[model samples]
Target: MEVPPSPTFPRALPSRSIPLAILSFLLVGVISLVILPHDFRLQEMFPSSCTNGAAASTSGQLADAATQPVVDLRVFLGVLTRPGMYERRAHLRLAYSLQPRPVRAVIDVRYVFCNLDKEEDRVLVAMEIIAHGDIVVLNCTENMDGGKTYECSPTSPTTTSARPTTDTYYRLAALADTLRDKPRDGLYHGFLNPCHQSRETQYMSGMGYIVSWDIAAWISAREELRHERGYEDSLFGWWMRKGGFKNVYGEEPRMYDYLDREMGEGVTCFRHELIADTVAVHKLKDRLKWARTLNFFNVTQGLKPSKMYDVDRLNSNMYHV
Candidate 1:
């Protein structure tokens, strides 16, 4: 009778529909959060932790460098000959602390090189330098080994007789004290035992004295401060936990001077113009080398470069050569 009981009005809306819609909306929200470039929670909580950690690790590594000394000068020369060596390279570790609270900091060197010759020079070579920083943290560790170790008392009687029996405990203690008290601003410089020194010289016989040498110099440094006294919460400890080495600032003055002297008038004529054009190019190359080295470390150790800070741009305006 009247439209066949109008298809029984749906008794009730399906119960699952509302829940399903809510679930879909929640899933989309979660996905959006995950896909976003920045995570508010992460920025708020662990903003610079990644970078700081890396720096700390690098700081601690300084001791390792001392333990296993490398032929720095040789390495430097080798790297010079093989520019590829500079690619994905981790050369130095650094530790330091900033002012105010005197928190410790650490950083690692990845790639580093210096360009000595101006563009106008017959020779053009750019040295590349790179480094990785863990994180900034406290340091509170003793150099029990006295910063050196002897596998066993020298078997040779002469060696044993000559060896001072007096323990090095006092010396270690003194070093520890010094490291602890080092000021935040104080800079620590560490050079490769045999730093590689390569000269890429370009000579033009036609132009009587036109000669240029492409040179590079690289080194590492660290800084630490004694903020708190005890072992716990020690600035060095925090530095280690963070990773190590965050940033590096150094100049190989000798190398630069050497290049200038070597190049002489060859690089003088259009120095201003040459510098202006090459500064950016050199920086780009340096950054490229750094990024590559960092990527290598990340892949090998599942570690990443610091995130809390950035390197001050290479000052192209300030030309040395």
Candidate 2:
């Protein structure tokens, strides 16, 4: 029932050489991410080397993806929004924030926003900031790209020699940060596209990506790594290859891109493609689309209506409820 390792993953790199004893234990789970909170000290929390990158595979227990334990995933869900998109922001807080946590993972939601140009708007934003302590307002102008700054929020690994910078990634109190203490024995970094790239060594959807605490720490802590790659996910991948770290890419189908469309073989349904426990979905630009997606997962498990009709009860039900 083992998921065959990606061609790039099975062979060990000289830079990332591991003792076979350790390697044997490392190959347990599929693609996953484990990030810790700022309040917890990294070394003290996860003192073992296994958490650095190598982790025992959680998927090996079952041959099929459906039967596997919902591996413990702690995600710092950072939703980026602009000033005028108040409705979109509200929908995120209401739907995504309210999403019932999966039995296998823990997810925390936070919105990353930039300063508003209109001075009059501050009054309204201030109220929102007060109501929900989740908003992170950067000093820079509000724009789509400002979300990139959230990458700066993670605490870096003390083991790395990456240089530090004056940027406020450390000073921001980490409201912009995602995920908290991952499994102590292993690393679980998340990414929407857990697949091999064509021209690029790593191809990841900026929307969602996962990594062990060490990888995120390496990127967030080091000031020099800030501008290394074009996108946040790519930058992390660049460092992985450059740093001689192993890439434990998981199954790509786990993260769906087709929101309401049919894909792959003969599956048919509006959001049937988005089955239960999809790690992440990308390119959700509109508020309504987000609502629909959330409703699909929460309200309608899939388009299939069975004889026993009550979706809440079904052998195929993937949800914990």
Candidate 3:
């Protein structure tokens, strides 16, 4: 047993083994550093792994980009939804006369509401006398179907083409011109004629009066939401109601609230204008004077008088006396 124990295997040399073990550990550490994708500094040593990680990151970035929301210009304009509170504070001007025989005169009025708080948008309006006196009402609702009821058999057509197709902007322009021409009939029977010297006079005149109304537009958050969620049945519908879609009445209340919040309480008027035959220089001059005076702020400077369809060349027939 003692002889056998003397032959026990000799242990490896500590110096050589220690060096070799240290070298093996260093090699593994270097290999891992080069192989790992997270090692940015060492990535150059393993281009494939680095490229894969970069590609993945790029794909993630692309996905995020694709999911980002887009901005809408219509929503920026309050008209996209119900009128905004800022619109109620609009400033309006009224100038009228009852002289020059035939009670001919002009009513010039102008105001800036909402959108114009920053910049102006030109508004070209056109209007035709619909009715007058007790029988006439400013049917601001161009499409008669709005407040009217249609009687039809169950199988009858549900729609009709009797309603007038009027452009709101052009109507405003026309109204502006009419207002510039004083002694014009009032568009609405109950409304006080801005041209009348007093409320009593306006009521008594029965002469009918002209009016000019316009609004500065701004992006409407409600409208934007409606467009986004028109088909959805959730939060968007709730916002649309708050924004004014459910109300059957006109936007007067909304406009009032908007103005009250922005302009503070003050006396305000909503007037209308009309268009005139520019061939009559004398009348045109007078009308222009009224327009300039009423619109002293030049709020209509940016309005486009003509649309794309109006590009046709004018002929002699277009001019009048």
Candidate 4:
């Protein structure tokens, strides 16, 4: 069999012109590279511009009263924390970020920490501060016996307390109700220490507590508090006593510890199973506890339905199990 003449196609670039075209393309690329900004970096070219601010939405996101209705009050809720507990802080951020904003109120959540001793923390924490704009770096050494919480007073007219793993999960609505009912100065609201001397002399437990702006300002004013050496909470109580500020409000079972079912043998007044209408739950201590606590509140209730997920099953397995 004889083959017919094959079809021929013209070349887009002739062989003679190919080298010149290649050289021109190469030159253009080189010129483009050279003409780029001297300090041109990928980060600068495609910068991640993250604006940190409270969003105004009832969709379980962090929000302030700025974009809402008339503001009745502003509460600075500072979480006393350490530089090393990054995971704990992340959990807390998620926990609070998913909470509904209190009506006519602003609950500014800030992470309060002592001086950064570690090099990694200095870098990482700085990044966090820049990213979140919700960190308070105190100028004292970190220690429970030291005046870390005391130092947080002068920083802001804020309520300083710890969070899960010494963290607290509280209902903002319940707290607002409590405060609205007792709108007065010299307010020291917390779980009263059970073994304390009397109602008049008793101190709030260290799990968590809240001091009104007046009480915090009073503590901040006393330069002598800087020299005091004792348990932070106990010292705070002593100061309350010294100042004769007797507007102490105790929330015993209302604000108690996370009750582990296995270790439910001997629960104290401040340690037991969770309850509805809770002002706060303490001793969340780990991720599992936090999961349970968050699940109890139905934090994910507003999540849009999707066939891509079986969140109910995931929740039951992840938390309930």
Candidate 5:
């Protein structure tokens, strides 16, 4: 059979219609920009599963935390623990680890560690785990790198006081506020690179960095995030600063090495801002040091500034677990 000829038009679009087509494309782009947000809010970053405490049926409080109103932030504190430091954990729980967090969705402090080599230690650790339900055994490494992955939970939480405004918290807020009021649309919607001049100037302090469960989830999901040069703080700071959450970092300074003794201030820090807005206190090893710290805060021994109580840490360091 013979083939039929088909009608054909010019290959190129008419020049007269070109301007209209371009205008339509530009219009669509503009409309899209106007409708979609620049970035997802920090509060809205977590998955629905994070808020669903069905996985925490054994925990009544956890279930409540899940059903509660939208949380501004949920902080998960990872306290490194090991075999014979059960007393330390007890001191912490009695001192301040058990305080209720204020104005937040959730605040859970977990005693994180790995499996023990000895059968006896393992047995003790297992008892601690079953008794507290606050223990997290990674079984992967003795290092805390794996713990960076934890972000949410329910029940007999790490149970620390509310989010202690560490330098990071203050910095996050300042950066956030700056981005919100910036003249430009913002580099990352709500982030402005405060350290654009020197990348070295930007970093988060790992000692006491408070982050939303959503942000934690995001960081944990990325498997490639690992330590280099064996400095977890430097790497963590770098990861967070460049996590696209903010261009610069903030320091919530209450995360002191020790309230007073660690900094050589010797009871002086108790009167400083570090005490008032305090969140996390690090470097307190041994039963004595922990006891002193607990006394210093509880004002069981010496004089405190706010008339809250008299706290002479040197004199009041008698209690222990």
Candidate 6:
């Protein structure tokens, strides 16, 4: 069969139309510049999602809202735990509930664990999930020193707190303020291992750590981390080093372990007595540690005068689990 050649149109625009075309292009560009925003922003793109009607009711308030950049950062703090630790969860819930909510930021506390094995866990955990709806079940078996943390990375939670390893009995407001200044991407904020060194090998302690959302996303995208063994924190450090990510180590008396007076007054870089400005306290292995830590923070200061009984007599240090 004979094939017909397609008609060839002019490759260039007409000589006379060139000036008109350029004028039209410039007009369109100017119109676009006038119509479009000077800067792209979440609020400008999706005003309804960014601002609540109640929040920006007044014209002045709305104007202020329009001027201000909307931050979409949410801190997902997941506490890794066994599904059977109902009492511990309850305690944690109480501890978190007592904290003042962060301003202009969401701090969601999620209980993370592997699949439920025991019948008690299945039942109680399901109940807890129904009541709270803040539990995360990873696709792995329950075991410490396993790749559970690696498994959790895909979930892309932001930070950790109020777990068995540490007692975060500090002001959430202060934390929120601190977090505001934190780098949005490529940051690992916590007490780094080998506090004296700023090397790549240094890993944030498992006691608690904070990874920005971008870092979490980067971690989730890597498949090699799934099979990596050894300490989860160390593996995370390795991964960060592999990716050339940055670490923001919280230094000295600011971020330290809970100093057991009974364990002697010997102090190191990471472990020391509680100070006025503590970001975190690690090694809260027992109820006594938590009690002492909480007491030190004056968590019970709001307790009103009661005729029932005096809370003053109850020594928090005496309570041990």
Candidate 6 local lDDT, 209-246, one digit each (tens): 65544455564565555556665566666666666554
lDDT of 2 at 304: 79
The candidate scoring highest on TM-score is 4
lDDT of 4 by residue, 1-321 (tens): 121242221111211111000000000000000011111122222122233333212212223233444644444454566799788778777777777767765455556667899999999998986676666676656554333333432233322222223356767667656655553444566777764456544666666565554555565566666566665556566766676554566777687877888665567666777787888887666677888888888877777767999767765655551
**Global lDDT scores for all candidate models:** 0.18, 0.38, 0.18, 0.53, 0.35, 0.49
For model 3, how does the per-residue alpha-carbon lDDT over 6-48 read when each residue is reduced to its tens digit?
Answer: 2211221222111000000000000000010111111111111
Q: Mark the 10 consecutive residues where model 1 has the least summed lDDT.
A: 20-29
Query: Rank order by TM-score, top first?
Result: 4, 6, 2, 5, 1, 3
Residue 315 lDDT in candidate 5 = 46
> Which wins on TM-score, candidate 1 or candidate 4?
4
Give the higher-lDDT candidate: 3 or 4.
4
User: lDDT per residue, candidate 5, 115-225, as tens digits?
Assistant: 577788788877866665666554333432323222233211111111111111111222223223222210111111232334444333334433332334444455465
Q: Lowest summed-lDDT stretch of 10 residues in model 2? A: 19-28
TM-score of predicted model 4?
Answer: 0.72
Best-fitting candidate, scored by lDDT: 4
Q: In model 5, state the lDDT of residue 196.
A: 39
Give the better candidate number (1 or 4) by lDDT.
4
Off by over 4 Å in 1: 1-52, 56-82, 87-103, 108-110, 116-178, 183-321
- Quote each prediction's TM-score: 0.16, 0.54, 0.14, 0.72, 0.51, 0.69
**Candidate 2 global CA lDDT score:** 0.38
What's model 6's TM-score?
Answer: 0.69
Off by over 4 Å in 6: 1-73, 149-171, 311-321
